[model samples]
Target: MTFDATFWALIGLILFLALMIYIKIPGKIAEGLDKRSDDIRTELEEARRLREEAQALLAEYQRKQREAEREAEDIISQAQREAKAMATEAKAKLEAYVTRRQKQAEDKIAQAEAQAVQDVRTRSVDVAIQAAEIIIADKVSGKLADELIGKSIKDVAAKLN
Candidate 1:
C-alpha cells in the first residue's frame, strides 16, 4: 500500500470524533442516569429490609421454642399433682371400705353371741323346770312353786346386771 497524508488525516479525525462521543455524547443523549442510580440504591435498601425481616422471623422461632419448653414443664407438673391427688383419694376410699367391713363383721359377731346366749338360756330354763317338777311332785303346791321360780329369776337378773 502507498501512504497518503489525506488518508491519515481522515483517520485521525474519525478517532477524535469517536473519543468525543464516548466521553461526552451519552450524557447529552440520555437524561435518566441519575434516576437509575437512585433506583439501584432503593433496591439495595429493600434488600436490607428483607434481611431484617428474616432475622425477626428467626427471633420469633426462638421465642416459640422457649414457650414450648415452659408449657411442657407446666404440663408435667400438673400431671404429678393429679397423680398425687388420685393416690390420696384412693387411700381414703380404701380406709373407708376397711372401716365399713370391720363394722359389719363386729355386728355379725354380736348377733351370733346374742343368739348363742339365748339358746343356752332356753336349754337351761327347760332343765331347771324339769328338776323343779321332780322336786315338787308330792311336796309343794303349784302356787308355792310358781312363787319360788319368780323369786329365783329376780335374783339372777339382779346379779347379771
Candidate 2:
C-alpha cells in the first residue's frame, strides 16, 4: 500500500497510546516528581537559613568575649590603683605616729630633768639647815640653842613665802 498523510497520522496516534498503556505510567507520577522537587528546594532554603543563624550566634559570642576581656583588664587596673593608694596612706600614718612618739619622749625627758633639779635644791637646803643647827648647839646652852634655832626657822619660812 502507498503511504498517505491520514495513514501516518493514525499510526502516530496509535503508537503514542500504545506506549502510554504498555508502560502503565499514570499522569500523577509527573505531578509527584514536581512536588518532590519543590520539597527538596524548600529543604535547601531551610539549611541556608540555619547556617546564617549559626554565623550570627558565633559573631555575638566573639563580641561578648572581647567585652569580658576588657572588663577584666579594667578591674585589674583599678585594683592596682587602690592598692597603691592604700600603701601611701599607710606610710603617711606610720610617719605621723613616729613623729608623735618622738615629741612625747622629748617632753618626758624635759619634765624628768626639771624634777631632778628641784629635788637637788631641796636636799641642799636641808643639809645647810642641819649644819647650822649643829654649830649652834656646840656654842650655847641647850635651851638657848633650841630657842634661837626655832626663831631662825620661823624667819626663814616667812622670807621664803
Candidate 3:
C-alpha cells in the first residue's frame, strides 16, 4: 500500500520539529528573552534611583528656601525695631529742645517784667521828689529853709536808689 499526500505532509512536519530541536533554537530564544528582561530590570532600577535622588534634591532646596525666608523676616523685624528706637530718640530730643527754649523765653519774660516794675518805681520816686520840692519852695521863704530842703531831698534820693 502507497502513502497518501496527507501522510507525507505529517512526516515533513515531524522532521522540521526535530531539526529545530537539534539546532537548540528554543533554548537560544529563551536565553535572549532572559537577557532582555535583565537589561530592562537594570534600567528600571536605575530609574528608581534617579527618582529618589531628584526627590532628595527637591527637599534640600525647599529647606534652604524656608531658611532664607525666615532670615528675611528676622531682618525686616530688626530693621523695624531699630527704626522705632531711632524715632523715639528723635522725639525725646525734640521735646527736650522745646522745653529748653520755652524755659529761656519764660526767663526773658520774667526779666522784662522785673525791669518794668523797677522803671515804674524809679519814675514814681522822681515825680514825688519834684512835687515835694515845688511845695516846699512855695511855702518856705529863706536861705535856711532852702538849705534844709536840699539836704532832705538828697537823703531821700540816696535811700530810694
- Local distance difference test, per candidate? 0.85, 0.87, 0.93
Where does candidate 3 clash, by residue pair? none
TM-score, one value per model: 0.66, 0.66, 0.64
TM-score of 2: 0.66
- The alpha-carbon deviation from the true structure for residue 75 of candidate 1, after best TM-score superposition, in angstroms, is 1.6
Question: Which 10-residue window in model 2 sums to the lowest lDDT?
Answer: 152-161
What total of clashing residue pairs does each candidate reach?
0, 0, 0
Name the runs in model 2 displaced over 4 angstroms: 1-29, 135-161
Task: Give per-residue CA lDDT, model 2, range 1-161, as digits (tens).
Answer: 89999999999999998888777655667778888999999999999999999999999999999999999999999999999999999999999999999999999999999889878766766776788788887787677888999987787667644
Residue 7 CA displacement from its true place in model 3, Å: 5.1
- The total number of steric clashes, by the backbone 3 Å criterion, in model 2 comes to 0
As a whole number from 0 to 100, the lDDT of residue 113 in candidate 3 is: 99
By how many angstroms RMSD does model 1 differ from the true structure?
Answer: 4.5
**Candidates sorted by lDDT, descending order?**
3, 2, 1
